[model samples]
Target chain A: MIRVVAGFFIVMVMISAATVYSLKETTQQLKAHKQQLSADILKDRAAIKVLRAEMAYLSQPARLEKLSRRFLALSPARADQMAKSVTSIAGRENFKQVAFPVDEFPLLLPQEKPVFRKKTVIRQPRVRKAGFYDRISLKLEKNE
Target chain B: MRSADLHIEGAKSGALEVARTRLIVPVSLFVFGFSLLLVRLVSIGLFEDISDRVTRRASAKTEIIRERVDILDRNGVVMATNLPAPSLAVRPSLITDPQEVADRIVRLLPDLNRTRVLNKLTSSRHFLYIKRNLTPTQVWKINALGYPGLVLEQAEKRVYPQGRLASHVLGYVDMDNKPQAGVEKFFDDHLSNPERSNDPLYLSIDVRLQYIMREELERAMDKFSARAAAGIIMNVNSGEILAMTSLPDFDGNGAIDPLAPEMKNRNILEPYEMGSGFKTFTVAMALDSGSVKLTDEFDATKPLKVGRRTIHDDHAKKRFLNVPEIYTFSSNIGASLVIRQVGIEVQKDYLERFGLFDKPVIELTGLSRPILPTHWGEIQSMTVSYGHGIAVTPLNMVTAIASVINGGRLIPATLIRKNKGENITSSNDYPQVISPATSRKMRQLMRLAVEKGTGSFARVEGYRVGGKTGTAEKVVNGVYDRTRKITSFVGAFPMDRPQYIVFALFDEPHGTADTFNMATGGWVAAPVVGQVIRRIGPLLGVKPVMDVKTEYQNLILAGNEKK
Candidate 1:
């Protein structure tokens, strides 16, 4: 009986030691994950600053005016041309039919209706919660 | 023999018991020590791990390094930025042979003095700087030499890619990490402080508009053989300075070569007797004080003499002239008579109200105070009425004229950008300097000037430009030099609803055949202002008013009918 009691005590100490080792490993993994997230946040902040600057550069009035003149063949609206539609409102009905405002006539003209066709069915990706060691293994597999 | 045997057995047993006791004591002590060591190892491995992690994180996050902030234009165009560079340093204590390393370095960097490098390397300090701002290729070449005690440190150096395009506005930074001039000096604190995460300072300048003005001004400077030229375009409503160029400017990245004394910034720093531009102010003062109406007439047929000095118009109109005619003809005699009718005290008070007597307190440095008369007497007031015997910067004159045209509220000129769609009403805290009616009359009279007077060259079709021209002879050695003149033009565009005010001035402009050999304001400066307006108008979102009637025609017709 005394021999059995000694053997049981040794087994209990060994189990407790293994539990402590696993707990320490988990804590280290948590720290590394937190550090990676923080790094990602910093990178995202830098990218956002760059994107905003690029957007501002692209939206500059002088550049937009140049692009419009080149690509769209648009020019600054003449004052008399802007007043022509309004003056037509005070004129006869035949005049209105003959010279309808370009801005307002877009709605009156027949337009092609866009057909909404679904290509691939939308679905959410499957999310799996893996342990630290399993995540390492999965990452290795992806690398391979 | 039996008794002796029995005594030996007893002694042997006693020896065995003593040995057993000694062995037990040492074994117990060993067990205790092993357990204590195990406990200590467990404590360190598990409990102390959190604190160790925190220390590692703290050290990792502590980047106590200085980095330079970027300088951008209003539209976020990079004007000045700090690029990462390598600089050579030396660990003096480790340098066993200083002369050997210096000889090798001098070959790679010929600009460095061999003796100076040797002395710095042989110094007693742990570290010493040999040279700063080395290119990547130079750094690699020097490091490949494999000299002992040599080190390379990462550094940042400023670069301006636009070269001399916006030099005066986006000033240069020095080696000591200090801004020297222009917007660089104006917003130095904002640029230096890293903790300021507020949006980067935005200027009201447009780079394209700045390019146009600088290009045109350069052409005029070359064409007219002028000593120096300065131009400014301001949004009359918001007091935003769109473009300001002072020629003979240096590149922000290049070494500042010496400049001539007269080629300084004549817009804000050098005050000049802005000849006839002061007529607008005189007319505004007379109209605001109710001393003279737009219909009031003055005798400008001959030169008017006051206190042994005669004030003459460049183009003599020997007839009774209305207020519009006086401004259109740029009649100094008529303007002097108008000031006399308003009296000296009122004229002085009006000038002070227009911010002409004080230094221009804007975002820029190097502002010079206006040279006002020491004592306000009849002769002083009369000559000052037509912009003589007093000197003020072109910026001051433009701001004053902007206030006169933009509904008579004096808004201080600002380089700071305003938010889009925000209300930009003039500052109402100050008293109204002139009534709306007087402001309208002044605009009409200025329009008349551009239509049929000295400012005729300033006209742009369908833009309705209005302005006054000034050609003041530079006072040399206390006597006005008739040949050396400072010609300038101050004008506003789309006069029916005035939007922008443009002013251009040429210092000591010589006569050229293209100008009909006449280096007057109307011939030289007015055309530059007109070109600046035409180029910058589209960039500033100011469209030409094609349908609006020309107000100049009606004003001229009214004046002619009265005659």
Candidate 2:
């Protein structure tokens, strides 16, 4: 009886010790994870700030205006450019009115139909006799 | 023999009692202690809740360390924000090799002075700063050097990505996180509060419109060779400043001298006599007081004399002119005559009602006070009527003009953007400065002026523009200098129902070849307003109706009624 009781008490103490040890280990892991997540959040926030500043800098009105003027044919929309209604625009002489189809999704029609042009073919150079270095250069050019 | 037998029996019983006592006490104590331990273990393992506590511990260190809030335009474009930066400092005493460290740092940051860095590194001082607000890559390179004396501290930098786009409006933040000027200085406490710093402040300014206004004003300034120029566009109904610009502006990110010419915000902080721009107020007050009708004729045939001061028209009609004709012609003599009928007391009351007697209230600091005459008499009244004796900022003029054209209710100008569904009219905050009928008539007078009078150059195609022109000889050395003049144009669009007010001013502009060597308001400033309206009208979503004559039929009909 004495041996049996002593064994039971020792088992209970070991079980409690194990529970405490596992809890402490888990708490430490969680704390480290929490720190890592915090560091990641800070990094992400800093990156976002940089991206926002870059976007604003790139989209500055003066810079955009200069770029648009240089590259694009588009300009600020004028008051007269806008139509009061679709019917008003359709009433124009150049406008081609098309009916909407019931069975398919709607598609916007371009004001003017796109024209198809024949593709031009390039003429090849005549082959000539080459030296050793010239042949190697030609091969290198072909690889590039 | 019986007594000895009793004593031996008693001794045996006592020994047995002692053994029983010892065994029972120890057994009970061990059993009680074991039961307590078991109960505690069960409670902890099965019943006690710790997930909430664990989560609290996990997230406690992740709380955001808030800095100053950002400033955004009406469209949620970030005008100003904070970026995390690394600052490099070194302990002079701990640096083992100052020469090597300085050389490495100079190579990392080319902008730093090598000699200065060496001096600081070799100094006897305990600590010294090498540089601040270093880029992450630079900080990394410096850290890789692994110098014991080099220390990196976390810091934040205020950045303005728009540069000089709205410099005067956004202002700039100092290195110490101090608010310096404009809205920054105005909303310091609110922006710095940690709890509210996450939320950005939205200003009423539209950066696109601001860019357009500044571009056109700068173009005009270049063309006319003006000393300075200022322009403002406001929602006439809500009194929100959509765009305001003052030329020779400094960049918000660069260091600025506080007293430099470029640092002056010409739109609000500088007061000008405003010349005939005040005539709009005169005519509005005249009609509102019922003392002078639109058809009432005033004699502009000759110069009028009041208190030894003669008032002459810059462009004399030399005939009896009605109120609308007088306004269209910008007749100073006629404006004085109209104000004469309205009386000085009534004029003063109207001026006070228009908020011209005080500095215009806005969400900005360093507002210029209106320069009023010390003595209020006949000459002061007449000169003030034609915008001479009294001086007010262009902001004040815009606000008062907005009230006159926007159905006569005086809505205070605000730089802070209003929230969606915010009821501006329900609060009864804006007081009626004039009758609605008078405001409509004033709108017509302005339209007629733009259509036929000195403001003809301000007319834009399809956008029915109405405005008045002012060309005032600037007061120099206590005398009116004819060589120097301040020309301005104040107008509103869509004459039938005006929605926006535009004001353009130029200081001492020299006449260009295109202007016929004339630097008057109609020749210089009016065209600037016209071009601005032409470009911004579409952006502002103001629809253009082709038939402008029909819209002005009411004005024509009203004029013919008394003719």
Q: lDDT scores for all predictions?
A: 0.77, 0.83
- Per-candidate iRMSD: 9.1, 8.6
| Worst 10 contiguous positions by lDDT, candidate 2 chain A | A101-110
For residues B37-155, could you state the per-residue lDDT of candidate 2 as single tens digits? 79979987996666855765555543566678888888877788888777899998898888888888999999999999999999998877788898879988988999888999777
Query: Which segments of candidate 2 are over 4 A away from where they belong?
Result: A1-24, A85-144, B1-65, B103-115, B550-563
Q: lDDT winner among the candidates? A: 2
TM-score of chain B of each: 0.85, 0.86
Model 1, CA-based lDDT: 0.77
Clashing pairs in 1: B301-B318
Give the Cα error of residue B332 in candidate 1, in Å.
Answer: 0.8
Model 2 lDDT, residue B174, Cα: 76
Q: What would the TM-scores of all predictions be?
A: 0.76, 0.80
- Please list the residue runs of candidate 1 whose C-alpha ends up more than 4 Å from where it truly belongs after superposition: A1-144, B1-62, B97-100, B123-126, B257-264, B421-423, B550-563
Q: List the residue pairs that clash in candidate 2.
A: none
